[model samples]
Target: MALSRDRMIEFLKRHDYDPNTLQSMETKEIQEAYQEVTKKLLGSYFHLTNDNKSIKTNSILLDMGELTEFKQKLKDCANDVITLIECLQEGYMKFDYSEVNDLLAIALKDMPMHKMQKISHIAYRSFQEILLSQIATALKGLPKEEFKVLEEFYEKRRNDTQFLHQTIDKLKDPATRQQILTMARVKLMVVKDFMPSNLYDVYRDYYNNVPQKLELVAKVRALTGLYSKEYLKEMPFEELETLYQDILKHNEQEEQDRKMFLKYSQAIQESVDNNDDEGFNEICYKAVTHLTQKQLSMLVEYMNGQNPFFLSKFESVVHEYKKKLHIKR
Candidate 1:
């Protein structure tokens, strides 16, 4: 979306530009004025904390009220970005270079040129701290060890534009890119506001290439309990689908086993409480076939400790069953 002339006029009006003055200016002139005024307004929130003679020049600080107001403005900007991202994901909207540039200009308008240049080294890293926080959230679920490495890397070379680009370029493989895109989409859904427009464009490209795969990838991740990028990169889509089905069957079988274990355990306990030797033997005999080896061992231990008679009866039943199996063979 391009910045409309009417939108620029409206913004100028709120900042005390006269309606008549704005109306007389050309669109380009109004845009330039808007940028200038926006910067000044944003910069007004900061005050120099150190004397001009001090060696440290970057001592800008915000007073309490200014900090509060500035935070609210960042929140507003974040909300707008969230909306734009949602629209882009839904295929109802697209972001142009000019619109993205306009958004970036507004976000960093308060910073000095040198600071802005360093921050803008990475297209996504150029936003304010609040927006960077959103990126952090999007990149969550990376293995903690890997995430720590990423954090350390960013902290070390954050100002090194060449290194950042080179690192990003290395992640050009489709599977790795899709993994990142999937994480961004999932995490961003829960985030309230603020993503850099350029980062949003990256997400847009993912959607354009593989619109339907995101949902399937999310489902496969949940089913297999695998969130690592390496896992996704190595597994093909067909394998993911197969693994999803296999996991579902395994889960269902486990659930059924849990229910059967509970049912037989209850029945065995009841028979023991009633002192019904016949019933206890019958329940144990039935349980042996359904329960796992560990479960049967536990039952044997419990029966032996609780009552000698029950233990004797259970052992007799097992012996008889084994004799019958040997005869059949």
Candidate 2:
């Protein structure tokens, strides 16, 4: 598929290329320009150095076709980051990290150790401040004495090369390394609120098996909305385990609710097709009991184009149920 012109312009402008340059360029020229700019922006992550000789000797080399694929993978990550930032701004913190994880795995295929190290160094240098600032904002409510540990650790990681190397070396053990990666993936799947940079810190703490002040455990538990980070920091390990269990249970319930709603939606559609008002009313009644107000509203919206009569009946059922709940309260 062709890239959207506006998105191409935005991407070019982001990399300091003037949008006006495209005015004189044909579509093919614009596509080539976008590809060249993408490679220039993302090349450092895969290439050890810009010098051809050095890249050949020290980096995992990709042919032209492979490089095109690699660029798309990096572009996928860039797009995910943009979506994540927008969602964060809108107060929807949950995200599915699996797609990004798969993309990164492909993008990093055959990447040399030195290249990985270089990418880590670049991430630390270029992205760490933004990540730390975001973390500070999220954890601002915590006591200064407690928050200081997190602040100091990030500062040391950036400035103290020895400390950083020592920390990285701890992951050299194959079993420990696999365990850390596995834990990071599992946490990403379950926690659902972490940014990419946050996974870096998560891997470090997971390898050490030490509970840092802002470690995944605390972050995951805090996301439950049942506890503050301040409270979680002091909470017993057993209680933390309980909170983890609660999170799993809540996630399971949500999945079940989603499946139920989908089934009812399909049944409603079938009822509409058959012109069965009786079946439609019955389905709406049962759906209201199983689905939340928001879910019911979504169902109403979905029905609007399918059958206006059914949509009105579903709305009436929803209103009646809500009124009954209010009276019970």
lDDT of each: 0.53, 0.53
RMSD of each candidate relative to the true structure: 22.0, 26.0
Estimated TM-score for each candidate: 0.36, 0.29
lDDT of 2 by residue, 180-296 (tens): 343333334322332454433433333233455447466566557777666665554556667777788888777876777688889999987898978887898788787878677
lDDT string, candidate 1, 203-321, tens digits: 33333224344556666677666466346534555665677788889878777766776787688789879998788778877877768886677667765776677677777888887
Clashing pairs in 1: none
Residue clash pairs of candidate 2? none
